[model samples]
Target chain A: MITLHDIGFSYGNNHVLHDITTDFHPGEIVGIIGPSGAGKTTLLRILLGELTPTQGRINNSSSANIAVGYVPQLDSGERTFPLTVEEMVLLGAAAFSRKKPWFDQSEKREASRILERLGILQLRNNRLSELSGGQFQRALIARALMSRPSLLLLDEPTSGIDLHTRQQVLDLVHELQTDGFTIILTTHDLNWVAAQLPRILCLNGTVTGDGAPSEVLTSQVVRETYGANMDVIFHQGRPVVVDSVNNGGNQ
Target chain B: MSYFTDPFQYDFFSRALIVSVLIGALAGAIGPFVLVRRMAYIGQGMSQSILGGVALGVVWGLDLYFGAAVAAGLSAALIYFVRNRGVPVDTAIGIVASTLFAIGVAVVSSSRDRRLNSANLLFGNVLGVDTEDIILVALVTVIAAIVLFRNYKTLLAVTHNSAVAAAHGVRARLMEVIFSALLAMVVVTALRVLGVLLVAATLLIPAATATMTFRTFRNITIASICLGTSFAIIGLFLSFHRNIASGPAIVLVGATVFAMNMLTSTTSQRNRA
Candidate 1:
């Protein structure tokens, strides 16, 4: 649905993204994995049209206009407003929709349905600050679903989450994929997000590798992308990624 | 009956009361966004910063309202720009507010303009309100209220998270400009009648009390308007009865109500515990 031809971005003299060329086809579950300063979040913002690439053009070659759902890092979205979970979710729709101040019956019902689907219907009236991490992540997902978007962008879904919450988010990604939502998420770790995706883009200041996890998760590309040695060990069918430095020292 | 009806008999006194009520409603209406966005200090800053503009207007023979609006609006835009450019919000506000306030003090103290009465500007003269003041206050109040009501959802969303809203295709920049404009209107309107020292009272105090009183933003806003208007009316009565400036009287009433609300809420929470 979208094609990027040689996109580059810079901050002052620091080039955050360098000649990043890729295509996001329809209904593809893709993961972008990179180190802390690899501009993963910057790239996500670029795709969301929130930030303009300092160079190159992004072509939305698809004939039909695509709607996008964006879930920012859960901790970053504002909690200062006296917003209920349902109200926050509905804001996704309201941002795209210039409806009346008072929500219509259908919008309210839709918000309720999404909350129920996310197992947060009981928390529909709870404030954003009142939610736990897992619940907040779920709330963000529910908010994204409010737009019924075909394309969803999640930034750092597991960066600050506990193991259980991480598993829940991974499961949510799986469920969203099954429901025909084209999901793209960014993560610094490979075992969490990249390993689960059908395809992964390894980035460090640019696109280091782009392909399936098996084809691209080779130790060479992993080292190149992360600037450190990482062991890509296969057990049965799944790949177990371990820090080579940590593993070697322990052994 | 004679004592109660005494103030209402005078035409100027009635005008002052009506204008104060309008100021209360508008200030209250815009206050929640201020509190929620945590821009109360900015509101206070802009209010005082307008003193410089009023001084400049007097020295240059310009309309005081126009000068104050320009100053307040410019300050808001400047602060937003600086903050967006990576300056911390507090630092940006602090620098802008203090510089403008200092300039105003310098201008007022130096210019010796007979029309620039420091006492009236600082405390506001309730008896000084005229017909044009009534018309201006009414127009601004009604328009601001209607605009706020119509765009509450969009404003709420943008205020919460502009980046997220932008992803959903909202023009966050435009919403911000409108918010700044609305804020300027509230401050400028209140500045003329309430004085800079007391403008925050109409805004921060009532809105703060409303938030303490209600759970939903809508309820809090409605409560703020009700509380603000009540404070204005009661304050106006007290001002007339005690021969105090209306601005100080209104602030005193608002402060009292805010204290009461805080006390009761604390008691209720303790009881529940």
Candidate 2:
């Protein structure tokens, strides 16, 4: 379990996150939903220890060493970086072994296994530029898994892909969560988050609402967070979100 | 061919060939990082700033290479410092490089030394290379090879995405500084053979060509080294036979290779489409 207490961050005089307190348990999937500039990426950076909060305390209860794996947003620059899928995945393992400058055969086998697990084994030798959006996402997931982290963080994994690919990626994340990996992902797709994720945290520079989708994803809460009117409907006991203006009329 | 063997008849020609090959390989190995990191302009800035150091050395009666190394290193450090202070990289590099280059020109104009040939310094004379220059180039080549070989993965990580690398416990700032310093060393060492006007081309063209022809980093690195060394040898041959300046000849050969690579890659990409 990891706990964040009163996490507040600022860049110079502009405060980004304020009084953010959250606890992440083992084997749970959490979705962070917010509009742009709501500090979603900033909060993820703080969790990954890339940025230190101005006022906060974090406690990790796991006895073993805590290793966190991060998957950043899709970067077009990395696609043309002249590295094969296998070599890119091996970079994740490089972070683990400090003494070995190059990956050994054992690390190669591990990378192959992760690629297999991610269902991209056939693309091991293919360059990153050759992979489609869905395949690239899978490859990035395999790279993150190379570290064997207890916590996995993904930032906007389904932003640019098609609807079918988005559903496939969400299914993969669900499978990982079922396999006992704690996952936290940020997204603006509230409908997908409500339908696929177990818990959602609505954020606008702070935690506006946090609970199961049915309890926290109300129309008023979403409007407060996103500054846009959204309609919330319960479809078979699960909240289904829709844009109020685009779907004909207000609720 | 007798054309190739004719240049090897003279000891000076052989030494110039050896120095060119060494510097070519070293610059080729280091060039990809500069290209991938989008620091090609920084390489240009460092090379141009070396003129200031050489001019200062001429005025003070000191070793010009040492002066160049100091000036280039200081400019690199200043660029790094300014980048951290929220200045954009291209703007900072421009400000520093032009200032140093202007100072170098001013110092050269005021100097009383009759033997300080600015044209020869700006455009290299391969035949003027001595044994000491060869040794220095060889030493720097070996050191650069070792440093790049040992830190290949770390450097790749930082180049790919610095924020992600930092998240994974890699010190991105330290790696940036180390790479900048290495770039400075290469620029300073390469000045004797390629000169300020052409060294940046030597550092960028081969790497750019390799990127067009290869799909993997290791292949790109190897291909860049081969291409750079070949251009150096061929350029030296042309210089010896055609009575042309060596630095321009080398840059021209590299440019031709880059054009060929671009043409072929475009055709292949069209075929794939």
Candidate 3:
């Protein structure tokens, strides 16, 4: 389990994250929904132990000793880095045990397994720079899985991709969740997440509400957190958020 | 034939050529890391700072090699320290190197010993590569090569992305220190052959030239070493006949090679386009 208690983080004079207290247990996918600049990234960083909180404490249970695989949002762009997909994934393995001289047969097999699972085994030898939006997201996920971490922290993984690709990526995340990986991903894809993920954390600087998709993504919570007036439409027993403000429809 | 045979048969000349090649190989290998990390300027800065150490040695009548080594090591440590303290690595490097270089120039200007020319320190005396200097450069080159080989993957990961490397459990700060130290070692060893001002070019140019031709990491390294050694040998011969500065000669050869490699790559890219 990953736990944070009363975590307050400040950068210089500005408070980025304030009084965050929560424990994320295993076998459940927690989706954090908030507007931009709402400290969702900072909160994720704090959980990953990448950023030390100015106030409060963090504790990790013995089970979650694996490195928290973080897929950052900002740095990755259309531009390509001079590395292969296999090389990128091998970098994740470099964290655990870099004592071996080379990536042996077993390590190569493991990397291939992850690539196959992510449906990008064919692109294993391809350069990372050549991948499209959805392909790159899947590659990043495969790279993260190379470490075999218990908890995966994805920061806006579905941001720049299109609608069909977004659904496919979220479906993959859902599959991973069902296969028992504690996943916490920050995303602006509220409607998509609401339709798929069971639990939700509606946050804006602080947790506005936390419960099932139905309880957390209400009209009042949406307005308070995102400044968005939207209605949750039940389509075939699934929650689909329809933005009345942006869609130019009668509320 | 007497001039050719005598120099070739002599132990000193053989040692000189071997040492120069070794130094070139070491600089070429470590240089790609420097280029990729965007610390090419640091190599130049550190090389120039070695003049301060040499000037100090001249003033105090101490061993110049030892003095240059100390200076390079200290400057490297300072760069590492500043970087660890969250200062920009390039800023720290620029400050330390330029400051020491200025001090060296000032000290030399004020000194009464008119015999030692600063121009020699800036260029090089490749013909004066004695047996002792050759052995010293060779030993250091071996050590640098071994260190680089041992931590190859870790260094690659660290250079590629520090934050990701850190998250993956690589000691990013420690790797930075190691890389800086290796650079210093290569600079100090190649100081006599390339001189302080132009040593960084020797480190940077050959590696950069090879990168344009080679696509993979392994090939880039091998191609860089070949380019470096070829330039060193040919530059030594040309400088011997033309009576030009060996440092500038070597750099010019590297530049020519770099231009050729770049042209070839551009043509190939255009062909594909």
Best by lDDT: 2
Residue B170 lDDT (model 1): 74
In model 1, the runs with Cα more than 4 Å from the true position are A96-99, A245-251, B1-3, B80-87, B111-114
Q: Estimate each model's TM-score.
A: 0.94, 0.94, 0.87
Q: Tell me the TM-score that candidate 3 gets on chain A alone.
A: 0.89
Global CA lDDT computed for model 1: 0.84
lDDT tens digits by residue: candidate 1, B1-273: 877799978998889988999989888888888888888888888988898888898788898898898889778877888899899999999888888888888898887776677777877778878888899989988888788877787888788888888788677888888888888888888765688777876888889998986777778889998888999899988989998888899999999989988999999999999
lDDT of 3 by residue, A34-54 (tens): 988888988887777778999
- CAPRI quality of model 2: medium
Model 3 bad stretches (over 4 Å): A74-80, A97-101, A223-251, B1-12, B73-96, B112-116
Give the winner by TM-score: 1 or 3. Answer: 1
lDDT-superior candidate, 2 or 3: 2
- Which scores better on lDDT, 1 or 3? 1
For all candidates, state DockQ relative to the true structure. Answer: 0.68, 0.55, 0.39
Best candidate (score: TM-score): 1
**TM-score (chain B only), all candidates:** 0.94, 0.94, 0.89
Query: Whole-model Cα lDDT per candidate?
Result: 0.84, 0.86, 0.78
lDDT score at residue B15, model 1, on the 0-100 scale:
91
lDDT of 2 at B229: 94
